[model samples]
Target: MTTLAPTEPLPRFAVFGAGAVGSYYGAMLARAGVPVVLIGRPAHVQAMRAHGLRLQTADFDERIAVHADTDAAAVAGADVVLVCVKSGDTEAAGAALHPHLGPQTAVLSLQNGVDNAERLARVLGRPVVPVVVYVAAGLEGPGHVRHHGRGDLVLAPFPQAARVQAALARAGVPTTVSDAVPQALWTKLVVNCAFNALSAITARPYGWLWAQAGVPEMLRQVVRECVAVAAADGIALDAAALDADVERIAHSMATQMSSTARDLLRGHPTEVDHLNGHVVARAHAHGLQAPVNHALQTLVHLLEQGRGA
Candidate 1:
């Protein structure tokens, strides 16, 4: 196994949301005896403060000792900060955490979108590492986070990444450091941009969504447009593998509704803008047309408007 150089004192880590992804990672680190603080909402923070973080997965359910705070002060003096907020809150999150970033602190965007790290870095005027998180998990309740499957990170290379990467791996979260991280990011982006909105808009599981009489054809079109945008952005990808990945999701998580779907159902804003909307914007910049992604974005926005009504 490739391992990162160890850092002494095991850096103080902060997670911006104690939601599903954030809680899982934070719980692992805390279990491994690394100091981890989770900054999140009042209910989660209160529950965690009283009983630590409750984590549920295929193998176990236990309360891990994680410092949970509703206060942004949870980020103070941290050596590594993982931005796990929803994509829409990226800018505000950066601003709120800016005062807490130490000179040597490393910020990593561990969210869904490909552009979050760049966006957050620009807002905070700090280098932010982009990580593609391949995990399917979510909050089961206020203080409880449930993991379904797949927990791995492919992080963009950064100066202090070796130390951070190894720590994460040691805490039971697998980490892969890659020079081709952008390719990985864009690939995930393509998959999400293609499927998430449709799943959310229809409020159907992947299997049901694609299994619709003509939905598979529409999905193929969406994937083609995303591939075109990726190519225009100079990203090399395995077309077959990408298609296979989409098929795998429909098969493996057939009963699963997307996070976007759950969010919209719960009346929370979805990250359609950063997902499909991102492909549209990037394609425009590259002088390529991404009609499929554009249409997907528009449909999701319409759904959002309907929900707002």
Candidate 2:
């Protein structure tokens, strides 16, 4: 029996680089009766193929029946491709998918960094929707994801956005398709700039940082600089409410380690260049100063260099 959405046939999805974020969303879509194929690593594919995808959220725990693969060729018939690799892997991931994607496939960049969509479009010679992911989940193990809280997405408007948003919302993924997505992406970038490096450098969570003296003020400076860069890029961020939003985010996710922190912990290269380093690069391009971001980027670079030493 073919299941149809309210107005259209549910789109087949292929989650590229299905790590924590990709696997979780794929699981959600599968649970909603949308066909999805998770293209991830060998271990994940093996586990999922054996036992299904184990998804544990705050509200529920279940194994979803979905397809899993380790090849980019698995995306052949997929209507949508969700890119979920790290910021540094955007170009390579795009290259891997270049020969596989259909002309009409809707590519969505679900990773961090505000410029990812633009980068991907350049690499693939096609448009890619930029998505701001507001989710707290991690790969607990192979083929397993433990969701802590918040599973929502804000996406740049595209021609197929209406159908996509309807499917996502029906699948319990809160979504908003808007024109303000550029600013929204910058806003999330601002948050990442403020916390990711510091967290990686200190090897601590937000609570530990909040417990430190002067850390809050330092973070404030970081956000202020990122906002300036965003303004220079013509984003016009909500300057008045920016501080409150950062504070709320820090306190709310106090126990969570920034993704950079996790990468450094695992001795993998962190996305410092894309986060704080990105602000510094753009600031220099505009002849603006971003000393705080520079310092953070430098420190993270040192950590990267010292890894395995």
Candidate 3:
């Protein structure tokens, strides 16, 4: 962990896949005087180019001026690259970035799923730090992002982690570099396995889903299955702690929809394959069963198929 001195200049940042999560973090960094370039869809890039990014949150609503582009080449000179693409696109994103990354460039995975960093590393042939993102956010429209609640990161310890943490901290994003990132990531995976699919299938928010009959027990079973899968994968996770976290999310972001739910609403593909589906796959690999997670994954896939019809 290399600490950034007060006199040292902030690193130039490139946010790949600048959707809701990317835009929110990039806006925060840009607002704090850090140089940020957001790579995203044409509509979002065009809108930001025309009139900056509109960031709406409970604390404040403001337009943040940041560089936005649709080209991967925009990442050429970035010192730090935040990979925010979905898990399915991790390798593609890494390959796209390979040609442009400098020798000292640090890539960080801000996407969900436990294996993203490893996948990206395989593609880039470089060390990619895994980051656990805990934020509820959504894109209201082109160039506009609405933050529901919480904006913090837990990063796997790496050479650049401290510098990245300092930069983000200056931007008002709480960051921690931990040695137990594998366990932390597994914990988050368990929570995602519990809620994301259920919320997406029901098209309801966390609080509403948690309020339904048998929903809490259902969530617990999902967590249990995920924990067993994690144990099989050699990552020890506390089931009780994960359960409490699931409950906390229901209350804390009561009105917030999961990213999967938002994706389904927009007719975009959800990351169910990476969440519950991943758990099921890993469970099978370990000669174990994750029935609850498998059921959720199957239901979400059915919903996706129905929507496509």
What ranking of all candidate models by TM-score puts the best one first?
3, 2, 1
In candidate 2, position 143 carries an lDDT of 78
Q: Per-residue lDDT for 180-234 in model 3, tens only? A: 8888888888888888998898989899999999999999999888888888889
| Candidate 2 TM-score to native | 0.96
Deviation in angstroms for 219 in model 3? Answer: 1.2
lDDT of 3 at 15: 99
**Residues forming the 10-long window of minimal summed lDDT in candidate 1:** 1-10
Candidate 3 minimal-lDDT segment of 10 residues: 1-10
Q: lDDT at 241 for candidate 3?
A: 88
Once superposed on the true structure, which residue ranges of model 1 sit more than 4 Å away at CA? Answer: 2-7
For model 2, residues 125-189, the per-residue Cα lDDT tens digits are 99999999999889989979999889999889888887778778778898887788888889888
- Candidate that beats the other on lDDT, 2 or 3, i.e. the better one: 3
Which lDDT value does model 2 have at 221?
94
Give the runs in model 2 whose Cα sits over 4 Å from its true position. Answer: 1-7
- Which candidate's lDDT is highest? 3
Query: How far is 28's C-alpha from truth in model 2 (Å)?
Result: 0.5
Instruction: Name the Cα RMSD for model 3.
Output: 1.6
Clashing pairs in 2: none
